[model samples]
Target: MIDPVIIRTMKTVKEIRLENARALANEGPAEFARRIDSSTQQVNQFMGPSPTRNIGDKLARRIEAAFGKPEGWLDVEHITGSDDASISGTRSAVLEKLLPEGSGNLVTWETPDDLEPDDERVWIDRYDYRYSAGNGVIQWEVRQKKALPFDIGFFKALGVRPQDCKLAQVHGRSMEPYLFNRDMMMICTAKTRVKDGLIYAVTFEDEPLVKQIFKEPEGALRLHSYNPEFPDKIIAADQLEGLQIAGEVVYRSGSGLAGGN
Candidate 1:
């Protein structure tokens, strides 16, 4: 039989992912699978009303990383029972389930409602062209675009100017398990300083590519990925003429999912 703890955790995590996935893609499971580099069948096994797969610690970590969530986010404390109970009664029931019938103290979960956007909400432009995280992709100027609202506080904490930020969609498995395909990326265009191990949206002769940049000695540069199947690509300093750094990736969400505030 499947472990009860596994069932509880999987159910809760899948619920969270499903809620966010709707905002990310209208295509559903197939789009989600493309983002995580897993087959659609595997994604279904973990999600849906009746999940057939157990979510292990490894897979949990991968999911957290792919969606830019905090570690252990998938393992939050879950209280079992009926949904019809009042909020306070639900807490008491959960406490009863966890502790003895009469316990010393009771702890309740606080689920604050999401705040609605206000007049001062910041909106960053999102483009239609898919930025490649695998091999380079040829893309033209932004013919279509949309604006996504972001909390101004988030930008202040990152020290990034809101106007200089652009949200772009990633489109390749080259950065699988980290930056999955169809993931929405927050690119900071204010600066061009290359940092080792930091992801950047760059261009080679007008072709767009998203990769972690490492500056090598003698002015050479190396592009790296989380997947071992893809080899590192090196660009000599002399080839810098064709290279252009569009922006540095500051945040990522699975397949255009915007769980981040």
Candidate 2:
């Protein structure tokens, strides 16, 4: 016998698919498929009258990520609309439902609607790449234009220039208790100097990683992870020439500390 929970989940997925299709009516199916990392033909099959495939858990999560929706977003029923305020409100409600009480201030999904003429916004370059916190990932250099916006004052407060900041996402749990998977990091590209007891986004042997670095007395470097399961990696002074310090992790958003380590 089929489980009722499975049936309900499938129904929810279908509803979400239809709603997303309607929302992307202007961009059409091709763009929607691109966003979800699926082919247009597969998308049509899922949306067709006689469907041959079902939305699995992995695909549902991928859809949510592509649309910038929170996890389990597709499992619930949401009111679809063309109104901007209504859409924003719905997003806020979803976030509130997922976050713990008193932690609501940690995340904000809305852009400030009230800004004085003198208040300037700085756009930080964001890359469609993830820096592995466990096993390093091969670095990809795809920059998304106008990814994150910050108030000009924000840079002044951090003592870092706006132009020097870049945003990237972290993947893996090797740096757990300090940095979590899928955390959005604000990297100061200008600060490449090796500093002890600091987290950095670096490339070693062509693999990009987010790890805390400690300079040894003999000019060697130790890459550290907060999660004890992962042992620290020590690089000999002579091999340091291969290490490229892309930037120091100045700020992070997600389930981690906001300040640099």
TM-score of 1: 0.52
Candidate 2 lDDT tens digits, 58-160: 8778877888888877666565445854764564455346443454232233443433334587767777454442333334465555466787988898899
**Which regions of candidate 1 are displaced past 4 Å?**
1-117, 129-140, 255-261
Looking at model 1, which ten-residue stretch has the lowest summed lDDT?
104-113
List candidate 2 segments past 4 Å from native: 1-118, 130-140, 143-146
On residues 136-177, what C-alpha lDDT tens digit does candidate 1 reach at each position?
Answer: 433334534646666689889888999888888877788877
For the record, the alpha-carbon RMSD of candidate 2 to the native fold, in angstroms, is: 15.0
Report the number of the highest-lDDT candidate: 2
Q: TM-scores across all candidates?
A: 0.52, 0.52
Clashes of each: 1, 0
Cα displacement (Å) at residue 126, model 1: 0.9
